[model samples]
Target: MEQQQIKLVVLDMAGTTVADQHEVEACFAKAARMSGLEASDEAILAAQGLSKRYVFQLFWRAQLGESHPDVETQVDKSYAIFKEVLEAHYQTQPVFPTDGCLKLFSYLKQNNIKIALTTGFYRVVTDIILGRLGWLEGLDENRIGNDDSIIQASIASDEVEHGRPAPLMIQKAMRLLGVTDPKHVINAGDTPSDLQSGNAAGVLLNLGVTNGTHTVEQLIGHPHDALIGSIDEIINLIEGIKQGRPSGKTADAYSF
Candidate 1:
């Protein structure tokens, strides 16, 4: 199949752009242990692409049962512990950008392709993470009045009615970026839901990166236009796709 032309690129934060899964998991485990609750990595991993509030609710429901009394109180206490741990550790062990991310952003910007960001994280948490990573430091001061300006625009879960597997956030990002045709936008993420969102949005290109939580084999079952192990591989794939050159086989052809 011929590659569809891409005009805008939408990126998912957390696992997709930042490399801090281990840190996040450790923080959650510590919080769970402190609360006298057992948290397994598998359970945490399953909630990878969900909002913080939703994640908290999932853990609460899992540990305290579906109809536990004072569920809100317990959830609040657990979340407080989680926040404390995250704040203390996130600053010291911030998430690092994936390899070639800066280069890819620069290349796309130079090529006049609009870049947008969408995340399951709330705006406040997003702000905190970006501040901790110093991601805005490399941008031009004139262009970015504040840290938020580092991105052309963003669609946070807090603003969207439906989260991942809904495509509302992706659609919102495309609209904010003035990308009319879904076929002209490329959605890149690390989860099956991410691919589903893009596919549901009718995006022309859906690129899955194995650098995040999901493996190549997991993404293969989804409708991704291409699959790569790292962000660096994206540039080459995009170039090939643009020139009508075959990049490689589907995700099914590659083992995790």
Candidate 2:
């Protein structure tokens, strides 16, 4: 029997494929305060990988009743501020790929593995970040890229009915990329939510990166196939899968 081969790699944007220097947190902190809600850095950090709008709503609903009269108002106001701040930050600040990001892309290209980026960000900011990185170069008006392009496709949280921890984005990505089997896809991100979504999708490998928003200690106890040290380490794991043997020499390659 022929061994199953990976055909798609779905990656998260902020902190996973893109270098984040607390820029997102700065924006979120501003929005959190602007909404007249108090959220600590720890709270905000824990909310990473979730839809931005959902995060605000979550915080607001937590503070107030789910049906509070002011919930929608606060969500709207603070999200607007977040958009302004985030757009300004990305427009003025430089954006770059994370460590080994290009290397992984090149490897996937060489092997014909489709790449899709899923984000907690909405479409406007997602386009901003992707455009800044020139990853949106060849995509059509539909925002569908391809392996021949920098990326194949991108799914923003707002595009789907549900976001991370729901598998909607991953399922949408698989549908968009023409992939049928979760056993042939690898989902990777920098947050526990990423793992949960991948698990929900039942992908071949649900992976996490420690070099991003979450540390090894933070990601432990999360259901995942592996929690690697960096994005580059995935090359090793994939190679092992291809070779039918895993040396597993890289520390933390599959820890929790």
Give the number of the best model, judged by TM-score: 2
Candidate 2 collision pairs: 145-152
Separate clash counts for every candidate: 0, 1
> Which ranges of candidate 1 are over 4 A from the true structure?
1-3, 137-150, 245-256
Instruction: Kindly give the stretch of ten consecutive residues in candidate 1 with the minimal lDDT sum.
Output: 139-148
C-alpha positional error of residue 13 in candidate 1 after TM-score superposition, expressed in Å: 2.0
For model 2 the local lDDT of residue 77 reads 91
TM-score of each: 0.81, 0.95
Q: Compose the digit string of candidate 2's lDDT tens values, residues 1-256.
A: 0234788899999999999977899899997887698788998999899998888898889888898999989889989999999999998999999999999999998999899999999999999999999999888887788657989998999999999989999999999989998888888999989989999999888888888989988988788878887787778877877876532224447554
Error of 2 at 233 (Å): 1.2
| Model 1, residue 180: C-alpha shift (Å) | 2.1
List all candidate RMSDs to the true structure: 4.0, 1.9
